[model samples]
Target: MAAPFSAVPTPFRVRAADRWWYGNCAWDAFGICAALHVDGHIETVCADCREPIVVEVRDERPDDQRLLFHCLVPAARWWADIVFT
Candidate 1:
Protein backbone atom coordinates (compact mmCIF):
# COMPACT_ATOMS: atom_id res chain seq x y z
CA MET A 1 0.00 0.00 0.00
CA ALA A 2 1.08 3.57 -0.56
CA ALA A 3 1.56 6.30 2.03
CA PRO A 4 -1.62 7.84 3.37
CA PHE A 5 -1.11 11.45 2.26
CA SER A 6 1.62 11.49 -0.31
CA ALA A 7 1.92 14.45 -2.69
CA VAL A 8 -0.12 14.24 -5.86
CA PRO A 9 1.89 12.97 -8.79
CA THR A 10 2.43 15.10 -11.87
CA PRO A 11 0.69 12.46 -13.95
CA PHE A 12 -2.32 12.76 -11.73
CA ARG A 13 -2.87 16.36 -12.71
CA VAL A 14 -5.39 16.56 -15.55
CA ARG A 15 -7.66 19.07 -17.23
CA ALA A 16 -11.33 19.25 -16.33
CA ALA A 17 -12.39 17.31 -19.42
CA ASP A 18 -9.79 14.63 -18.88
CA ARG A 19 -10.70 14.42 -15.25
CA TRP A 20 -14.37 13.93 -16.10
CA TRP A 21 -13.59 11.30 -18.70
CA TYR A 22 -11.37 9.28 -16.40
CA GLY A 23 -13.52 9.89 -13.38
CA ASN A 24 -16.87 8.92 -14.91
CA CYS A 25 -15.74 5.72 -16.50
CA ALA A 26 -17.76 2.51 -16.71
CA TRP A 27 -16.62 1.76 -13.19
CA ASP A 28 -16.78 4.88 -10.96
CA ALA A 29 -14.72 7.73 -9.54
CA PHE A 30 -14.73 10.57 -7.06
CA GLY A 31 -12.34 12.82 -5.17
CA ILE A 32 -10.87 16.29 -5.26
CA CYS A 33 -8.75 18.46 -7.56
CA ALA A 34 -5.99 20.82 -6.51
CA ALA A 35 -3.82 23.13 -8.57
CA LEU A 36 -0.16 23.05 -7.72
CA HIS A 37 0.14 26.84 -7.21
CA VAL A 38 -2.68 28.55 -9.02
CA ASP A 39 -5.23 30.98 -7.63
CA GLY A 40 -8.90 31.71 -8.30
CA HIS A 41 -9.11 28.37 -10.06
CA ILE A 42 -12.49 27.41 -11.46
CA GLU A 43 -13.90 24.97 -13.99
CA THR A 44 -17.22 24.25 -15.63
CA VAL A 45 -18.80 21.76 -18.00
CA CYS A 46 -21.86 21.55 -20.15
CA ALA A 47 -24.61 19.86 -18.26
CA ASP A 48 -26.12 17.97 -21.15
CA CYS A 49 -23.01 16.24 -22.46
CA ARG A 50 -20.90 16.61 -19.39
CA GLU A 51 -18.23 18.36 -21.40
CA PRO A 52 -15.73 20.74 -19.88
CA ILE A 53 -16.03 24.15 -21.44
CA VAL A 54 -14.57 26.69 -19.03
CA VAL A 55 -11.57 27.02 -16.80
CA GLU A 56 -10.11 30.06 -15.03
CA VAL A 57 -6.93 30.14 -13.02
CA ARG A 58 -4.11 32.46 -12.08
CA ASP A 59 -1.08 32.74 -9.81
CA GLU A 60 -1.75 36.20 -8.39
CA ARG A 61 -3.79 36.42 -5.19
CA PRO A 62 -3.68 32.76 -4.38
CA ASP A 63 -6.07 33.30 -1.53
CA ASP A 64 -8.71 35.14 -3.57
CA GLN A 65 -11.43 32.90 -4.98
CA ARG A 66 -14.31 33.50 -7.36
CA LEU A 67 -16.54 31.56 -9.72
CA LEU A 68 -18.89 32.47 -12.58
CA PHE A 69 -21.19 29.92 -14.17
CA HIS A 70 -24.30 29.74 -16.33
CA CYS A 71 -26.26 27.14 -18.20
CA LEU A 72 -27.43 27.40 -21.78
CA VAL A 73 -30.36 25.14 -21.17
CA PRO A 74 -33.68 26.93 -20.94
CA ALA A 75 -35.64 26.96 -17.69
CA ALA A 76 -32.35 26.40 -15.87
CA ARG A 77 -29.82 29.12 -15.28
CA TRP A 78 -27.36 27.03 -13.28
CA TRP A 79 -25.92 23.86 -14.70
CA ALA A 80 -25.74 21.77 -11.58
CA ASP A 81 -28.19 22.08 -8.73
CA ILE A 82 -25.87 24.10 -6.51
CA VAL A 83 -27.15 24.65 -3.01
CA PHE A 84 -24.85 26.41 -0.62
CA THR A 85 -25.32 25.46 3.00
Candidate 2:
Protein backbone atom coordinates (compact mmCIF):
# COMPACT_ATOMS: atom_id res chain seq x y z
CA MET A 1 0.00 0.00 0.00
CA ALA A 2 1.11 3.56 -0.65
CA ALA A 3 -0.25 4.77 2.63
CA PRO A 4 0.05 8.59 2.37
CA PHE A 5 1.67 8.32 -1.03
CA SER A 6 0.06 6.87 -4.12
CA ALA A 7 1.96 4.52 -6.37
CA VAL A 8 0.53 6.27 -9.42
CA PRO A 9 -0.98 9.57 -10.33
CA THR A 10 -4.44 10.27 -8.97
CA PRO A 11 -6.77 13.21 -8.47
CA PHE A 12 -5.90 13.28 -4.80
CA ARG A 13 -3.10 15.72 -4.02
CA VAL A 14 -2.67 16.99 -0.53
CA ARG A 15 -0.73 19.63 1.39
CA ALA A 16 -0.58 18.87 5.02
CA ALA A 17 1.81 19.23 7.92
CA ASP A 18 3.90 21.56 5.80
CA ARG A 19 4.54 18.91 3.19
CA TRP A 20 3.04 17.64 -0.03
CA TRP A 21 1.65 14.15 -0.33
CA TYR A 22 -0.28 11.89 -2.68
CA GLY A 23 -3.19 9.73 -1.71
CA ASN A 24 -4.35 6.39 -3.01
CA CYS A 25 -7.87 7.79 -3.11
CA ALA A 26 -9.93 10.64 -1.84
CA TRP A 27 -10.43 8.87 1.46
CA ASP A 28 -6.70 8.38 1.72
CA ALA A 29 -6.22 12.08 1.09
CA PHE A 30 -8.03 12.83 4.29
CA GLY A 31 -6.30 9.95 5.93
CA ILE A 32 -2.97 11.57 5.19
CA CYS A 33 -3.96 14.70 7.02
CA ALA A 34 -5.11 12.71 10.01
CA ALA A 35 -1.96 10.67 10.05
CA LEU A 36 0.13 13.81 10.14
CA HIS A 37 -1.92 15.24 12.95
CA VAL A 38 -2.27 18.64 11.33
CA ASP A 39 -4.61 20.66 9.18
CA GLY A 40 -4.48 20.13 5.44
CA HIS A 41 -5.66 21.26 2.05
CA ILE A 42 -6.55 18.91 -0.76
CA GLU A 43 -6.66 19.76 -4.42
CA THR A 44 -8.54 17.47 -6.73
CA VAL A 45 -10.94 17.40 -9.63
CA CYS A 46 -14.44 16.18 -10.18
CA ALA A 47 -14.37 12.68 -11.60
CA ASP A 48 -17.34 13.28 -13.89
CA CYS A 49 -16.97 16.93 -14.88
CA ARG A 50 -13.23 17.40 -14.50
CA GLU A 51 -13.85 20.63 -12.66
CA PRO A 52 -11.47 21.78 -9.98
CA ILE A 53 -12.30 20.82 -6.43
CA VAL A 54 -10.67 21.84 -3.20
CA VAL A 55 -11.06 20.32 0.25
CA GLU A 56 -10.04 21.89 3.52
CA VAL A 57 -9.15 19.83 6.53
CA ARG A 58 -9.37 20.96 10.13
CA ASP A 59 -8.82 18.65 13.02
CA GLU A 60 -8.50 15.95 10.36
CA ARG A 61 -12.08 16.38 9.20
CA PRO A 62 -13.07 17.59 5.77
CA ASP A 63 -14.63 21.02 5.81
CA ASP A 64 -16.06 20.92 2.32
CA GLN A 65 -18.54 18.75 0.44
CA ARG A 66 -17.83 19.64 -3.15
CA LEU A 67 -16.53 16.15 -3.71
CA LEU A 68 -17.68 12.70 -2.73
CA PHE A 69 -15.59 9.57 -2.24
CA HIS A 70 -17.17 6.89 -4.37
CA CYS A 71 -15.52 3.55 -4.68
CA LEU A 72 -16.67 1.05 -7.28
CA VAL A 73 -14.38 -1.63 -5.92
CA PRO A 74 -15.70 -3.53 -2.98
CA ALA A 75 -13.71 -3.31 0.24
CA ALA A 76 -13.26 -7.08 0.23
CA ARG A 77 -11.65 -7.01 -3.22
CA TRP A 78 -9.46 -3.91 -3.02
CA TRP A 79 -6.35 -5.99 -2.65
CA ALA A 80 -7.02 -7.86 -5.90
CA ASP A 81 -5.88 -4.80 -7.84
CA ILE A 82 -4.97 -2.07 -5.40
CA VAL A 83 -3.58 0.21 -8.03
CA PHE A 84 -6.82 0.04 -9.98
CA THR A 85 -8.87 0.54 -6.86
Candidate 3:
Protein backbone atom coordinates (compact mmCIF):
# COMPACT_ATOMS: atom_id res chain seq x y z
CA MET A 1 0.00 0.00 0.00
CA ALA A 2 1.08 3.57 -0.63
CA ALA A 3 2.26 5.71 2.25
CA PRO A 4 -0.10 8.23 3.74
CA PHE A 5 0.15 11.74 2.42
CA SER A 6 1.63 14.56 4.42
CA ALA A 7 1.72 18.35 4.16
CA VAL A 8 3.66 19.30 1.08
CA PRO A 9 6.04 22.18 0.77
CA THR A 10 5.17 24.87 -1.73
CA PRO A 11 7.60 26.45 -4.13
CA PHE A 12 9.23 29.69 -3.04
CA ARG A 13 8.81 32.21 -5.83
CA VAL A 14 10.81 35.43 -6.45
CA ARG A 15 10.90 37.25 -9.74
CA ALA A 16 14.32 37.53 -11.40
CA ALA A 17 13.74 41.20 -12.14
CA ASP A 18 12.87 42.05 -8.54
CA ARG A 19 16.50 42.08 -7.48
CA TRP A 20 17.06 45.14 -9.61
CA TRP A 21 13.56 46.57 -9.31
CA TYR A 22 13.76 49.44 -6.79
CA GLY A 23 10.25 48.78 -5.50
CA ASN A 24 11.30 45.42 -4.15
CA CYS A 25 14.17 46.80 -2.09
CA ALA A 26 12.38 46.14 1.15
CA TRP A 27 11.27 42.75 -0.04
CA ASP A 28 14.80 41.96 -1.15
CA ALA A 29 16.31 43.05 2.16
CA PHE A 30 13.63 41.23 4.09
CA GLY A 31 14.32 38.09 2.11
CA ILE A 32 18.06 38.37 2.72
CA CYS A 33 17.70 38.80 6.46
CA ALA A 34 15.15 36.02 6.59
CA ALA A 35 17.35 33.73 4.55
CA LEU A 36 20.46 34.34 6.64
CA HIS A 37 18.60 34.85 9.90
CA VAL A 38 21.33 37.22 10.93
CA ASP A 39 21.52 40.31 13.06
CA GLY A 40 23.32 43.65 12.48
CA HIS A 41 24.60 45.13 9.22
CA ILE A 42 24.68 42.89 6.18
CA GLU A 43 26.52 43.23 2.87
CA THR A 44 25.59 41.22 -0.16
CA VAL A 45 25.09 41.44 -3.90
CA CYS A 46 21.98 42.18 -5.89
CA ALA A 47 20.46 38.90 -7.01
CA ASP A 48 20.16 40.09 -10.60
CA CYS A 49 23.15 42.30 -11.46
CA ARG A 50 25.50 41.28 -8.64
CA GLU A 51 25.88 44.89 -7.56
CA PRO A 52 26.70 45.58 -3.93
CA ILE A 53 23.74 45.55 -1.55
CA VAL A 54 24.04 46.88 1.95
CA VAL A 55 21.51 46.78 4.80
CA GLU A 56 21.80 47.86 8.40
CA VAL A 57 19.34 47.60 11.28
CA ARG A 58 20.38 49.72 14.19
CA ASP A 59 19.69 52.75 16.34
CA GLU A 60 18.23 54.99 13.63
CA ARG A 61 15.50 57.43 12.83
CA PRO A 62 12.14 56.13 11.59
CA ASP A 63 11.70 59.09 9.26
CA ASP A 64 14.57 58.02 7.05
CA GLN A 65 13.36 57.19 3.56
CA ARG A 66 16.73 55.83 2.49
CA LEU A 67 15.87 52.69 4.40
CA LEU A 68 13.24 51.96 1.76
CA PHE A 69 14.24 53.66 -1.48
CA HIS A 70 17.31 53.65 -3.71
CA CYS A 71 18.69 55.75 -6.55
CA LEU A 72 18.56 53.37 -9.45
CA VAL A 73 19.20 54.02 -13.11
CA PRO A 74 16.53 55.04 -15.59
CA ALA A 75 15.60 51.48 -16.46
CA ALA A 76 15.09 50.41 -12.87
CA ARG A 77 13.64 53.75 -11.87
CA TRP A 78 10.71 53.04 -14.17
CA TRP A 79 9.56 50.33 -11.74
CA ALA A 80 10.50 52.17 -8.56
CA ASP A 81 6.95 52.86 -7.45
CA ILE A 82 6.22 51.14 -4.16
CA VAL A 83 3.91 48.31 -5.11
CA PHE A 84 2.53 47.66 -1.64
CA THR A 85 1.72 51.30 -1.10
Each prediction's TM-score versus the true structure: 0.23, 0.79, 0.27
RMSD to the native, candidate 1? 11.3
User: In model 2, what is the error at residue 31, expressed in angstroms?
Assistant: 1.5
Give the 10-residue window scoring lowest on summed lDDT in candidate 2.
59-68
Q: List the global CA lDDT of all models.
A: 0.30, 0.83, 0.37
Put down candidate 1 lDDT per residue, 10-48, tens digits, no spaces: 212223333322222111111222323323223345546
lDDT of 2 by residue, 9-76 (tens): 77799998787888888888888888888899999988789999888998756796564677899989
Q: Which has the better lDDT: candidate 1, or candidate 2?
A: 2
Question: Top model by lDDT, which number?
Answer: 2
Off by over 4 Å in 2: 7-9, 65-67
RMSD of each: 11.3, 2.2, 13.2
Residue 83 in model 3: shift from native, Å? 21
Candidate 1: the clashing residue pairs are none
Using alpha carbons, what is the TM-score of model 1?
0.23
